[model samples]
Target chain A: SAVISQKPSRDICQRGTSLTIQCQVDSQVTMMFWYRQQPGQSLTLIATANQGSEATYESGFVIDKFPISRPNLTFSTLTVSNMSPEDSSIYLCSVERSINTGELFFGEGSRLTVL
Target chain B: DQQVKQNSPSLSVQEGRISILNCDYTNSMFDYFLWYKKYPAEGPTFLISISSIKDKNEDGRFTVFLNKSAKHLSLHIVPSQPGDSAVYFCAASKERDGNNRLAFGKGNQVVVIP
Candidate 1:
């Protein structure tokens, strides 16, 4: 299993403000995933970050709204731009532990609250 | 359009009893199913998994049963213990697709009574 760590385990922010969440993996991985879990909701993938290339955003998610940076294999950052109340959720980073099984190891998650 | 669904939001069971949680999926492409356990303020940890080729997979006290025809799967905890209380998430993915993507359910909260 891979060890993933995220900054700002929890945060409180005002509407219209932007916050950047950083994710660091203990080892290098080819790809890292970003997911959001809203209150009482399932985990939704925001984007897939690949090293040395642009991040791929999922449907209903855009680069302008959630800019992602994958500077290296072991590190990535996700920025929430002009966040609104609806953006309040727990953001998590994960890495695939096995390609055959598609098992993922997740970070502790960063809980964000917007006012 | 949630691909994975856990119809039950919560469940309570007495110690030494069996705790069963069910999940259904809408995507036939999903051939690999997994269950994750999450404690408060922590990320989900993989508990068990079953590939489409097999209908059941068992670990120490946890067992996962998969039904490819119905696109449904379940996790059973034998002799449930208080430490087993946590939110369980059902996730699915296509092993051959090579997409490395997993669709997860909302999660089921389980409580084990003493």
Candidate 2:
């Protein structure tokens, strides 16, 4: 497990607004991921934050809706654009704990409530 | 479509008793199975994992059992403690797929009472 920190642990946003969540890791890592868990739902992978390149999004997620930026290996950000009530969920940042096993260490998630 | 299924949404156990969580997967491509635990207002944390080549892996009080033929897996926690109460998630993936993407299932909330 790595020392990971996220900003805006909890927030309430209005519909049609946008919010950006920041994830900071203690050490430089090659792979950083973003995951979202909706109410009563499982965690879904939003994208993989690749350093020095555009993030790779999952099938159901689009880069326009969820823009990601990885300026450096130790820092990354996920922006939820044009949010709606249905977009309320807990977003998390995780780093690969072990590449061989694909184990991840997650930070406390950022909980969003869109009204 | 949900590839992984955890039938029971919740489980309750007494202290010092055993807590069992079951998980089933429909995708045969998933060869690596993992269990994660989450507390309220926190992200899910890695617990234990088993490879397709192995049937069982034990770590301290937590043990994971895998039955590849049946596409079923289980997590057993012996001598359950109150601190063990949390939501446990079942996740599967193909390690060598190059991408570390994982499919997660609805977590099971386990309450340990003394």
Candidate 3:
């Protein structure tokens, strides 16, 4: 199992301001991902943070809105740009422990509230 | 489209009883299925998982059963304890394009009463 840590566990941001969330893993991992969880909703994958390349965004999400950076295998950051009330959600970082088992370990999410 | 669905929003069980959470998926291509437990203000913790080829996998108090033909899977917790109360999520993934992207289901909140 991999241990992950996310910064700014909870934050309140003014509308139109951008906030960046950092994710750090205790060990190097190949597959790192970002996910969002709205109030009373299931987790939704925002993007896959590639170590040395651009992130792969999911449908309905764009890099312009949620920019992601993966400088190395152990660290990644997700930025929510031009935030709106709709952007207020719990953002989580996860790492795949093994591709064969397809099990993921998640960090404590960063809860965002836009006013 | 929700590839995975957990129809029940909540479930309650008495301590020491069996807690069963069910999940269904429309995508048969999903080769891996997983169950996660989450507490408020925290990220989900992996509970157990089963491969599409296997029908059942057990981990001490937690067990996962998959019915590939029905495209459904379930998690069973025996001797449920109050500490087991939390939101449970089911996730499915298919290996495609070298990426195994997970599809999550709406969670089911389980409350274990003492």
Q: Identify the candidate with maximal TM-score.
A: 2
Please give, for every candidate in the order listed, the TM-score of chain B alone compared with the true chain B.
0.96, 0.97, 0.96
* Candidate 2 CAPRI-style tier: medium
Q: Candidate 2: what lDDT? A: 0.93
lDDT of 2 by residue, A1-115 (tens): 5899999999999999999999999999998999999999888999999999899998999999999999999999999999999999999999988884657899999999999
- Candidate 3 lDDT over B1-114, as tens digits, reads 989999889999999999999999999889889999999878899889888889999999999999998999999999899999999999998866343478899899999999
User: DockQ for model 2?
Assistant: 0.67
The residue ranges of model 2 lying beyond 4 angstroms of the native Cα positions read: none
Highest DockQ model number: 1
Ranking under TM-score, best-scoring first?
2, 1, 3
lDDT of 2 by residue, B31-95 (tens): 89899999987878899999999999999999999999999999999989999999999999986
DockQ of 3: 0.65
Better of 1 and 3 by DockQ: 1
Once fitted onto the true fold, the runs of candidate 3 whose alpha carbons sit more than 4 angstroms away are B97-99
Model 2 chain A poorest 10 in a row by lDDT: A96-105
Give the worst 10-residue stretch by lDDT in candidate 2 chain B.
Answer: B94-103
lDDT of 1 by residue, A6-47 (tens): 998999999999999999999999989999999999998899
